[model samples]
Target: MPQGSSKKRERQYEHVKDSAKKRGASESRAKEIAARTVNKERARSGESKQASKTSTQDKKSASQRGGERSHSGSQGPTKDQLYAEAKKRNIEGRSSMNKQQLAKALGR
Candidate 1:
Protein backbone atom coordinates (compact mmCIF):
# COMPACT_ATOMS: atom_id res chain seq x y z
CA MET A 1 0.00 0.00 0.00
CA PRO A 2 2.92 2.30 0.64
CA GLN A 3 4.34 4.25 -2.25
CA GLY A 4 8.06 4.28 -3.12
CA SER A 5 8.40 0.59 -2.23
CA SER A 6 10.46 -1.84 -4.25
CA LYS A 7 8.90 -3.02 -7.51
CA LYS A 8 9.14 -6.65 -6.38
CA ARG A 9 7.21 -5.93 -3.17
CA GLU A 10 4.53 -3.98 -4.99
CA ARG A 11 4.12 -6.77 -7.49
CA GLN A 12 3.95 -9.33 -4.70
CA TYR A 13 1.19 -7.34 -2.98
CA GLU A 14 -0.87 -7.11 -6.15
CA HIS A 15 -0.41 -10.78 -6.91
CA VAL A 16 -1.48 -11.77 -3.42
CA LYS A 17 -4.50 -9.48 -3.54
CA ASP A 18 -5.60 -10.79 -6.92
CA SER A 19 -5.12 -14.38 -5.81
CA ALA A 20 -7.22 -13.85 -2.68
CA LYS A 21 -9.94 -12.09 -4.65
CA LYS A 22 -10.06 -14.95 -7.11
CA ARG A 23 -10.43 -17.31 -4.17
CA GLY A 24 -13.69 -15.49 -3.21
CA ALA A 25 -12.31 -13.46 -0.39
CA SER A 26 -13.99 -10.13 0.44
CA GLU A 27 -12.19 -7.00 -0.62
CA SER A 28 -11.04 -6.15 2.90
CA ARG A 29 -9.98 -9.72 3.53
CA ALA A 30 -8.08 -9.79 0.26
CA LYS A 31 -6.31 -6.58 1.12
CA GLU A 32 -5.45 -7.87 4.57
CA ILE A 33 -4.07 -11.09 3.14
CA ALA A 34 -2.04 -9.20 0.56
CA ALA A 35 -0.66 -6.79 3.14
CA ARG A 36 0.24 -9.59 5.52
CA THR A 37 1.92 -11.58 2.77
CA VAL A 38 3.93 -8.61 1.49
CA ASN A 39 4.85 -7.58 5.02
CA LYS A 40 6.06 -11.07 5.81
CA GLU A 41 8.20 -11.04 2.68
CA ARG A 42 9.52 -7.63 3.58
CA ALA A 43 10.39 -8.83 7.04
CA ARG A 44 12.09 -11.93 5.68
CA SER A 45 14.14 -9.77 3.31
CA GLY A 46 14.97 -7.21 6.00
CA GLU A 47 13.00 -4.52 4.17
CA SER A 48 10.73 -3.98 7.18
CA LYS A 49 11.56 -3.38 10.82
CA GLN A 50 9.26 -5.95 12.38
CA ALA A 51 10.15 -9.60 11.93
CA SER A 52 7.96 -12.52 12.92
CA LYS A 53 9.64 -15.52 14.51
CA THR A 54 8.35 -17.82 11.75
CA SER A 55 9.60 -15.51 9.02
CA THR A 56 12.98 -15.20 10.73
CA GLN A 57 13.31 -18.95 11.15
CA ASP A 58 12.15 -20.06 7.69
CA LYS A 59 14.67 -19.53 4.92
CA LYS A 60 12.39 -20.54 2.07
CA SER A 61 10.17 -18.10 0.26
CA ALA A 62 6.39 -18.47 0.89
CA SER A 63 5.81 -19.83 -2.58
CA GLN A 64 8.71 -22.27 -2.45
CA ARG A 65 7.46 -23.64 0.84
CA GLY A 66 3.94 -24.43 -0.40
CA GLY A 67 3.86 -23.81 -4.12
CA GLU A 68 2.88 -27.36 -4.93
CA ARG A 69 0.12 -27.46 -2.33
CA SER A 70 -2.12 -24.72 -3.67
CA HIS A 71 -5.95 -24.87 -3.68
CA SER A 72 -6.11 -26.77 -6.97
CA GLY A 73 -3.52 -29.32 -5.82
CA SER A 74 -4.18 -32.87 -4.64
CA GLN A 75 -3.86 -31.72 -1.05
CA GLY A 76 -7.22 -30.07 -0.54
CA PRO A 77 -8.12 -27.84 2.36
CA THR A 78 -7.57 -29.39 5.78
CA LYS A 79 -10.36 -30.30 8.20
CA ASP A 80 -9.60 -27.40 10.49
CA GLN A 81 -9.49 -25.02 7.57
CA LEU A 82 -12.83 -26.27 6.31
CA TYR A 83 -14.24 -25.99 9.77
CA ALA A 84 -13.15 -22.37 9.97
CA GLU A 85 -14.80 -21.66 6.64
CA ALA A 86 -17.95 -23.44 7.73
CA LYS A 87 -18.00 -21.28 10.79
CA LYS A 88 -17.62 -18.20 8.63
CA ARG A 89 -20.54 -19.31 6.49
CA ASN A 90 -22.57 -20.26 9.55
CA ILE A 91 -23.08 -23.74 8.21
CA GLU A 92 -25.37 -25.97 10.20
CA GLY A 93 -24.19 -29.23 11.73
CA ARG A 94 -20.60 -28.43 10.88
CA SER A 95 -19.39 -30.01 14.08
CA SER A 96 -20.75 -33.36 13.00
CA MET A 97 -19.49 -33.28 9.44
CA ASN A 98 -16.23 -34.87 8.38
CA LYS A 99 -13.74 -33.17 6.07
CA GLN A 100 -15.24 -34.63 2.91
CA GLN A 101 -18.77 -33.86 4.04
CA LEU A 102 -17.82 -30.32 4.93
CA ALA A 103 -16.19 -29.79 1.56
CA LYS A 104 -19.24 -31.19 -0.18
CA ALA A 105 -21.65 -29.11 1.85
CA LEU A 106 -19.67 -25.97 1.16
CA GLY A 107 -19.70 -26.79 -2.55
CA ARG A 108 -15.95 -26.52 -2.71
Candidate 2:
Protein backbone atom coordinates (compact mmCIF):
# COMPACT_ATOMS: atom_id res chain seq x y z
CA MET A 1 0.00 0.00 0.00
CA PRO A 2 1.11 3.57 -0.55
CA GLN A 3 1.89 5.88 2.33
CA GLY A 4 -1.13 6.95 4.43
CA SER A 5 -3.46 4.22 3.14
CA SER A 6 -6.26 3.67 5.66
CA LYS A 7 -6.65 0.70 7.96
CA LYS A 8 -9.50 -0.59 5.79
CA ARG A 9 -7.35 -0.51 2.68
CA GLU A 10 -4.54 -2.26 4.51
CA ARG A 11 -6.90 -5.02 5.64
CA GLN A 12 -8.34 -5.37 2.16
CA TYR A 13 -4.86 -5.73 0.68
CA GLU A 14 -3.92 -8.45 3.12
CA HIS A 15 -7.15 -10.31 2.46
CA VAL A 16 -6.72 -10.21 -1.29
CA LYS A 17 -3.08 -11.25 -1.04
CA ASP A 18 -3.87 -14.22 1.17
CA SER A 19 -6.72 -15.30 -1.06
CA ALA A 20 -4.47 -15.19 -4.13
CA LYS A 21 -1.81 -17.20 -2.38
CA LYS A 22 -4.43 -19.79 -1.36
CA ARG A 23 -5.42 -20.02 -5.02
CA GLY A 24 -1.83 -21.06 -5.93
CA ALA A 25 -0.32 -17.74 -6.92
CA SER A 26 3.38 -17.21 -6.18
CA GLU A 27 4.21 -14.78 -3.34
CA SER A 28 5.19 -11.95 -5.65
CA ARG A 29 2.18 -12.59 -7.89
CA ALA A 30 -0.13 -12.59 -4.91
CA LYS A 31 1.26 -9.28 -3.70
CA GLU A 32 0.88 -7.79 -7.16
CA ILE A 33 -2.71 -8.91 -7.41
CA ALA A 34 -3.49 -7.52 -3.98
CA ALA A 35 -1.84 -4.20 -4.71
CA ARG A 36 -3.63 -3.78 -8.01
CA THR A 37 -6.98 -4.62 -6.51
CA VAL A 38 -6.45 -2.27 -3.57
CA ASN A 39 -5.15 0.50 -5.78
CA LYS A 40 -8.08 0.26 -8.15
CA GLU A 41 -10.45 0.41 -5.21
CA ARG A 42 -8.66 3.38 -3.74
CA ALA A 43 -8.84 5.14 -7.06
CA ARG A 44 -12.49 4.31 -7.45
CA SER A 45 -13.28 5.72 -4.03
CA GLY A 46 -11.24 8.91 -4.57
CA GLU A 47 -8.79 8.03 -1.85
CA SER A 48 -5.80 8.43 -4.18
CA LYS A 49 -4.43 11.55 -5.85
CA GLN A 50 -4.46 9.95 -9.30
CA ALA A 51 -6.98 7.62 -10.90
CA SER A 52 -7.21 5.85 -14.26
CA LYS A 53 -10.24 6.07 -16.51
CA THR A 54 -10.93 2.34 -16.36
CA SER A 55 -10.30 2.07 -12.63
CA THR A 56 -12.87 4.71 -11.75
CA GLN A 57 -15.40 3.85 -14.46
CA ASP A 58 -15.50 0.09 -14.33
CA LYS A 59 -18.99 -1.30 -13.65
CA LYS A 60 -17.88 -3.74 -10.98
CA SER A 61 -15.40 -3.46 -8.14
CA ALA A 62 -12.53 -5.94 -8.02
CA SER A 63 -13.92 -7.59 -4.90
CA GLN A 64 -17.38 -7.83 -6.42
CA ARG A 65 -15.94 -9.42 -9.59
CA GLY A 66 -14.49 -12.27 -7.53
CA GLY A 67 -12.53 -13.88 -10.38
CA GLU A 68 -15.45 -13.71 -12.82
CA ARG A 69 -12.91 -12.88 -15.52
CA SER A 70 -10.30 -15.38 -14.45
CA HIS A 71 -9.54 -18.31 -16.79
CA SER A 72 -11.49 -16.57 -19.53
CA GLY A 73 -9.02 -16.90 -22.37
CA SER A 74 -9.88 -16.80 -26.06
CA GLN A 75 -11.72 -20.10 -25.58
CA GLY A 76 -12.45 -19.86 -21.87
CA PRO A 77 -11.35 -22.73 -19.65
CA THR A 78 -9.55 -25.52 -21.51
CA LYS A 79 -11.10 -28.81 -22.61
CA ASP A 80 -9.03 -30.65 -20.03
CA GLN A 81 -10.41 -28.44 -17.28
CA LEU A 82 -13.95 -29.16 -18.40
CA TYR A 83 -13.23 -32.87 -18.56
CA ALA A 84 -11.72 -32.91 -15.10
CA GLU A 85 -14.80 -31.22 -13.66
CA ALA A 86 -17.07 -33.66 -15.46
CA LYS A 87 -15.16 -36.59 -14.00
CA LYS A 88 -15.36 -35.12 -10.53
CA ARG A 89 -19.12 -34.75 -10.90
CA ASN A 90 -19.41 -38.35 -12.14
CA ILE A 91 -21.01 -37.29 -15.36
CA GLU A 92 -21.53 -40.40 -17.48
CA GLY A 93 -19.87 -40.73 -20.90
CA ARG A 94 -17.37 -38.01 -20.03
CA SER A 95 -14.54 -39.90 -21.68
CA SER A 96 -16.32 -39.94 -25.02
CA MET A 97 -17.59 -36.39 -24.72
CA ASN A 98 -15.94 -33.64 -26.71
CA LYS A 99 -15.04 -30.32 -25.18
CA GLN A 100 -18.33 -28.71 -26.13
CA GLN A 101 -20.31 -31.66 -24.88
CA LEU A 102 -18.39 -31.75 -21.64
CA ALA A 103 -19.00 -28.04 -21.14
CA LYS A 104 -22.72 -28.47 -21.80
CA ALA A 105 -22.93 -31.50 -19.51
CA LEU A 106 -21.25 -29.59 -16.75
CA GLY A 107 -23.58 -26.64 -17.38
CA ARG A 108 -20.78 -24.27 -18.10
Leading candidate by TM-score: 2
User: Which stretches of candidate 1 lie above 4 Å from their native place?
Assistant: 60-108
Candidate 2 C-alpha lDDT tens digits along 1-108: 899999999999999999999999999999999999999989999999999998998898656788776755668778899999998999999999999999999997
RMSD of 1: 11.2
Q: Kindly list the per-residue Cα lDDT of model 1 for residues 1-108, writing each as its tens digit.
A: 766579989998999999999999999999999998888878777887768788777767767777643456576789999999999999999999999999998998
The true-structure Cα RMSD of candidate 2 reads 6.0
lDDT of 2 at 66: 85
- lDDT against true structure, model 2: 0.92
- The model with the greatest lDDT is 2
* C-alpha lDDT of all candidate models, in order: 0.87, 0.92
